[model samples]
Target: MDSMKNKIKLLAVTHHDKKNINPIRPEASQIIGLHRSGEVDVLVLCNPGSILIPYFEKEGIEVLTDPLEKKLSISTVLNIRKLIKNRDVDVLHLFNNIACSNGATAAIGTRCKVIAYRGQTGNVSRWDPSCYLVMLHPRLNKIICVAKAVENDLRKYLWGDKSRATTVYKGHDQSWYQNESADLSDLPIHDDSFKISLVANLRPRKGLHVLMDALALMPEGINIDVLLVGADSNNEKIKEMIQRSTIPKRVHAMGYREDAPEVAAASDVIILPTTKREGLCRAVLEANSYGVPAIVSDTGGNAELVENGISGIVVEPGNPKELADAIVQLYKDRAQCKEFGVNAKRRAVTKFNVEQGVDATIKIYKELTK
Candidate 1:
């Protein structure tokens, strides 16, 4: 073990403006935890006057609000280069594509090891010059993919040095599991109702239409309620689909909630019927931590998180009938659902805890720095 005298000084950069919540928050929290534990000295670089500034400042983590514009700004690069030189940063970790590109460029000729966190499974075309340049950037020492599925896609499409890519599952703090569930009594759902939650941003690829179709096909006697917890980007389209469905009354569109973990705790089971591959579903992991089983589509790393017929059920992607049947099966067999929930919680605590993810990342940092 390295002594406190040999601690690493790391800087994290995110492209997200803090008006709305970003996926990078959880990782930021983990980094803050590491800072608190005296494992590393950390600083965050984000947009000027971002909402996240005060939030991190309260916890004593340093924040640099250098306004990074849409296009690569030379001024921003120079600012970052100056900060790196002054702080003697050992590693520079970037959260998004823009930050990765810009930070890698700024870290050129410096001792700072650049590590990029990739959380999407989308293919990068060689035709896209920016994607091509970022993938082949020589200054990039490590690429931390959020899932094996994402790493596979990155290697297949981006043509990078495959050895540099490593899979590091995103982790959730244990406090999410310890917190009391939110009071959802105001909703139309009854105590006896089988509550199913879909906690993802409203997107076409999320397959909410497929879920609506499945709900429409359910038998008349099924006592179930669906909670949609996310920002409705395609509000009109989802409203139209819900309006056309037979079970419109049973579905509640509870737009983005701050108490997502509490919502998951109150749910009997979680569902993600995404048509496209996910890097790794943080929602599913959160649900699992709450001892809620999930019925996820067999795409990307969904299958990696869920054990079919054990922790949770994995169904064919975009297949409403299969999804409906799986829902019905779990709803009918409450005992099985409970069993899966227990198994899911066990797996989550042991395999996907925040500390585990932080430790893995620290190992990588030490490796690169050494």
Candidate 2:
């Protein structure tokens, strides 16, 4: 083991809905980006349900799938073990808790280091029992939480051992925003009307209800059209919420789109009314990258991104009145919006680009190897 090459081969495995895989999370993109840049060798093992196989294969990264049913499958575990042994993988990075639990168990004989990545660190009740259970494994060296808020929550609710934790902020495409020649006509909305866009899934955690309530309370003089971009996942509650809303005409529930920056560009102000405990949200950075001001709720990393009244507005999570007030304030003051937008973009360019994130992650990996 001491004489082994320093070159790292990382295995990122996720079990999400197939259609939702590509358009949804930034994990796959991050891994592929790193692999393409020759930073590391990534072998993606997604749920058999995901179509990410072709995408990963296209990028020249080895892709594998497991027929792991909802319940634990012994075959799946064995197959993963075989893959790890064949590739001589240096680290096994699990994107979700289920995979982490399985990977921990699989690494028992091989003594391979395991790292788990958590996107959100909510309350104890929100945590998967598998994550807590995986901590029992000695091979599991670290858990990467996307934000400091999540790291705090993990120490408070789940794991008290802070030594095994690390925080890594998700990066965005900074150059896309800086490239003035990039075209945005491909985005769904190109109209000149006052546009307010929400780039989140139509899930309860995202606080779409709060956003709707705020829209209802918006000032009478403000004429704003909203584009709520996200997948429904057949959630009846969200469906009913969208159906029951009176602002259907004003709000276009255009489902998920890969070109999120394009949608951000078509908007005047981006809104993220998340009530759930989020880690570092990429949407905020992406929104800020396009020089679009945001009115985010005071949840997770929202406060960290929005510089109060300077770059953007941060209101109480799930507070419709406060959200409405902030939105109206920005609406009435276009100059303030422009000022905040400029600052937001500057912040994104300087701090949250993909290259910076990759550099930080590689540094961590190198340190871990040493």
Residues 205-281 of candidate 1 have per-residue lDDT tens digits of 89888788888889897899888888463588667767655887888878878778778889999998988857788
Off by over 4 Å in 1: 1-5, 19-24, 133-136, 200-202, 231-234
For all candidates in order, the CA lDDT equals 0.82, 0.72
Q: Give per-model TM-scores.
A: 0.91, 0.82
In Å, residue 16's CA in model 1 sits off its true spot by 3.3
- Model 2 TM-score on a 0 to 1 scale: 0.82
RMSD of each: 2.6, 4.2
Give, for candidate 2, the lowest lDDT window spanning 10 residues. Answer: 181-190
Residue 9 in candidate 2, Cα distance off native in Å: 3.6
* Residue-level lDDT tens digits of model 2 in 249-275: 566666767666667776789998999
Worst 10 residues of 1 by lDDT: 16-25
